[model samples]
Target chain A: MKPLMESERFVRLAAPILVGAFLIGGWELACRHWQVPVFLFPKPSDIARSLMNDAPTLLGALWVTMRITFQAFLCAVVLGTLIAFLFVQSRFLEISLFPYAVLLQVTPVVAVAPLIIILVKNTQAALTVCATLVALFPMISNTTIGLRSVDQGLANLFRMNRAGRTATLLRLRIPSALPFFFAGLRISSGLALIGAVVAEFVAGTGGRGSGLAYEILQSGFQLDIPRMFAALFLIAFAGVSLFLLMAWLSKLALGGWHESEVAREA
Target chain B: MLALNHEEAVTSHEATASPSRKPSIVDVLSANKIYADGTEALAPVDLSIAPGEFLTLIGPSGCGKSTLLKLVANLIDPTDGRLQWWRGGFDQVGGEGRRLAFVFQDATLMPWARISSNVSLPLDLAGVPSAQSKPRVAEALKRVGLEGFENRYPRQLSGGMRMRVSIARALVTNPDLLLMDEPFGALDEFTRNRLDSDLLALWWERKLTCVFVTHSIYEAVFLSTRVVVMAARPGRIYRVMEIDEPQPRGEAFRNSARFADLCRQLSAWLADASLPSPVRASP
Candidate 1:
């Protein structure tokens, strides 16, 4: 009932939807009124129409991309977390290897995607490796910092209780790292999509197993701009949805107590 | 590594009052803390906390009052001398089926956990399963006068409330000894005063042996059964004074002439403690 009234929650929900509708409606109207060429910049209506016309192929491409993204994101989260654990456990290991982690992050995935594709012998696996490299850095950086960020006082408290290493790691370190871990998830989700798309662009494979990037390349070659726009729309939509999903997951896990998740009373 | 059951804890408490029994819960035999860099944080300090005593350590910043508390809590190893916890025999802290708790200067609550979870942290660290520790957590919260706040997060509560939660966390294990490091130092004056009395009530009810560290002379005077004054240079004890005020110390006590006189004396001790060569100045 309170959400339905003049609260910030009401405004937060309505503002974005209303503004997006207005912008899209205006773009559609202007395109039609000005006799704009669809090739130059397709109207929202044309994009929507193309979406329906190419629904099956476009969605299949979307599924391929999503599958790669999921695989990469999962690998990044797991492998990155393990790396963070290693770093947390041993200062010597972290010092010896952190620079290399940074090197992997800074090197362009596009520059290495072709080599990976050549070496891996499987296009899907190659795309996943590239995407994982792109998504991996944030997870390592955030989780390591989070694991190291235990409150000094609380650390003392644990010591005073004579908590063993396993107890400290499982109970204290893991919970302390959750907020930071989820924050990394939000960033990595989008990077996963970007990485997969970039990898596909470099791979340029054109069988039925192609992802949205291949469809995009094909549409470009044929001058089918509307279909390209439709694919682009799907990618953008997917990224946004992934972000919202992670934000929701963060809220679900931490909303009861975390400062970032607890709803502001105002 | 082990904890006393409720019955065992009660029996221990009863035995504590026996004339034949030793009154000291902790004996700091000339304990000192020196960092890895050879900088001395505290000089050798000898002190003993008797059962059910409220002992406050008051000193200026950089004094080793907090260092002393940490030594007793066994959070850090002392550079010199022995620190012992009493459990029939003088033994190390944390493994004697003996319970003690420490409240840090900051609330030190896990921001991602509910108040109940924060309070149950010690029990969890001690490996007490949640099914068994839930009632103890609830009782601790009740003792802190925060009965319905078990579900709230640390951030949801105000500063004063957060301190109460910290105290509740300290109280959850039915600890025989409690160490507090300026627990109410961050609160507003009114809130501090309110919490001051609330803390006293809890102390009186629990009959806890508390070693509190604070910079405020008035706070040290009001809350303590004995106030130990410390001085910085190498962080040594300056003086120890007993405040013979009655239990459940309240507003009347706060406004009493005796309270003011004691505060003045403690303040003088602190003032002199901070001066360069207080003995030289006196001479």
Candidate 2:
């Protein structure tokens, strides 16, 4: 029983890798057997070769997109938390401004991206702003709900202690909100990457710092389907990495206490 | 028996002990609670808590025992009348010898914090430096028999241990008045008995004034110097009974025929309290 339990994590990792490998193997064989055109659907081998050959360009594009995502995510976290704090401080403020936050989330970023680029002279700044807007809502909404979800008993305990507002916020509210806040981070991190890629697509900016989206755009125009696949692969890899990073962080912060992150024996 | 003047009863009980009595630690003068929806949680009643007294308030559900406890803790304000702390306004609370602490039904420890941190919350909230609070936290945990479990999170501990942590958190303030609202209500019977025993020892050792609320008649009979039985439907005190038992009570007192008799009497009072109030036409 102990040995089987110990091997569970390994089994979890192995199962997915096996399936992915099998699928990729089948795809390569089917394409080879049919002699499919490379332009129509790039083979995995072609995509890999393209990845190796254009390593420097693809890596640079990856870095640019990642920087934008990180920047937008950081800004969204800071501003969204501040906004949530204000919302918790007063119901009047929340009622007045929460609809606008919902409005921002509902509106399509593609439509807003072009207008933002035109208004902001720096293309990079415009892209970052667009990404930030796209990523901001989940942080706001999730954090507001979290901050308000304090245990009534704990709240009364704090009150009985004569804890001032600042002490209550810092000691009680913040700790209570952490699990929900981390949940928001897991979601918003992926959204930030999506927002960055989408904004770059709308901007269509091309230069030394052009992102993976621009690389894909350029490859499409040049009919380099293998290179386009490589770019798409990089974006997918980055999105997954961002998500995993957020999950790791959430675990680091809440693993000891939160039921969501704590490991329990079956 | 409705709205018994508990102060008078307490005075009579202590008549043989001393003539120069200390002032009541708390006074509830005509204090009552009515919710926003107009549900009367408690009817206007006057009561006083003498220092170092173990007073238990027992009632059925919706009896406002919790409401009365909250009012004493000042967690919620009474909708009418007022409560006096240390025979003065709330501003005098938290003073050197006038400190108050509360234990909730749920453990209410911050799950994210280690036991030591949770226990030290009151001190930390009071801006006491860590150097000053560390020893007090250790001492409080020791009192609750949770020493050396400081680094464990609330979730890591069992329900009984978590409740001990809650008690330690209350004790860390070195409070004169301890208001506990069914602190052991969620525990198993064995654990509840153990906690009740430990709690009585603590109260005796510290000479603390306690206003404990519980549904357990035996618990009230065993622990309190005086028990205030309350009734629901515009909740109010029904009767106040004096235990007339020896101090520092233990298993001997618990197993004695006198203990059984007292418990039986309290059980009858609780049954009476649980009956629906007499209907009255709206004014």
Candidate 3:
């Protein structure tokens, strides 16, 4: 019964887009009227055209970055979860080594990227490793907390039932740890993408197989500000897409019953 | 009883628990618990559990009724005296492959498991195959009037339904003794009364020896064949009232004069217990 402009879904979709269009339209008008220098601040229209114009090259670099980010994310999830499992199994082991994990997180990835690049031999592999390190810590801490935070009453029930360690782990601890694990995935996915880009920026790899970071670097050197913006846009879009994909996966896994995933009626 | 740390009050307690027609199964001979920090959690107490007895332990908070249940459950060791089970077995329940189940204050159902799986947990832990356990799980659920809800998860159920699932889980093992620690304290009165009658039905049909812990005097009077009232501050048993009201306790029993009198008496006993001075244990 309401007008199209006033509907909830319509407003939700239209509001941000209208703001974006207004900003872009104003920028384009200012650029044309004042004849703003392209290198100083390119218009949104110029950026869009630049994206299409250099589509193959910028997109190719994006593909490389995406591959590194994906690989690093998978590695971080598996490796970090395994470490968390190990840490939970032994208190002394966790106490001895958890500080090292914190140390890895605190140390700048740029500092480690050079050392990793030097040691790993393959540039892509080194970048993946650097990204994995960046993405690893949240998974470790989140999953550790999840695994440790089993309901005490349930734990007592298991003990009363004479359930063995393996049974307890499988039936109780692992299932309880899932929501926290997925939450870790959401955070670590974004960190993984950021890690890949930062590692690429520090490595500064060139030639045919280089990533978006290198394109960004080259664009800066050539004063191709539009190209740089285009590359930056791709990275931002990919980060958002990755986050959304993780959120979707979390909902798929936990939507049926978990408190965090269940939809509440107002 | 060991003489070193335990003061033997067994003779006096044994003298009090009259040698009746009911055959004693579990004998708590001056059994008491003192924590590691030397705080007396349970003062020296004695009791006897016979088959087909519904015993409710009623007391205020920190009265160690739950601790006594744990002692019966063999979840903890007594610092003094002894808890003898089934005559010279010298073993906890399920130790010699006989089953017993403890229902906690919370439902304690696995949040991730379906109701059927939760009910089947004990059988699974006992290495009973799924094929063999299915019928039994279904039977347990049916006993609790939750037959169709086997596929539902714990979160999908209401508070009372979840507690039913917990009870079904406990019943799956066809336990000889059931230990419950305030299992209905969280529920509203309507649900609590329904569960009380349902529990009584289960008790009658199964002929189970149940040691139930609660703070509610009316609940104690309604569900129990005997109510053991306790006092706090080193947690000692103060009085034991035997409910001689006949079995198959119908709805009318709640309205009877005896029920009100029993409830009032138990309430007064509990109030007397809450007083600072330690009340003498009645014979």
Locate the minimum summed-lDDT window of 10 residues in model 3 chain B. Answer: B1-10
DockQ-wise, the better of 1 and 3 is 1
Off by over 4 Å in 2: A1-6, B1-19, B93-98, B277-283
Query: What fraction of correct interface contacts does each candidate retain?
Result: 0.93, 0.93, 0.57
Name the candidate, 1 or 3, with the larger TM-score value: 1
- In order, the Cα lDDT scores of the candidates are 0.86, 0.88, 0.88
Predicted chain B of candidate 2, TM-score versus the true chain B? 0.89
Pairs of colliding residues, candidate 1: B1-B95
**What DockQ, on C-alphas, does every prediction get?**
0.71, 0.77, 0.58
Span of 10 residues, lowest total lDDT, candidate 1 chain B: B1-10
Give the least accurate 10-residue stretch of model 3 chain A, judged by summed lDDT. Answer: A257-266
Cα lDDT, model 3, residue B146: 98
Alpha-carbon runs more than 4 Å astray in model 1: A1-10, B1-17, B20-23, B87-97, B277-283
Evaluated at residue A21, the lDDT of candidate 3 is: 90
Locate the minimum summed-lDDT window of 10 residues in model 2 chain B.
Answer: B1-10
Clashing pairs in 2: none
- State which candidate has the highest TM-score: 2
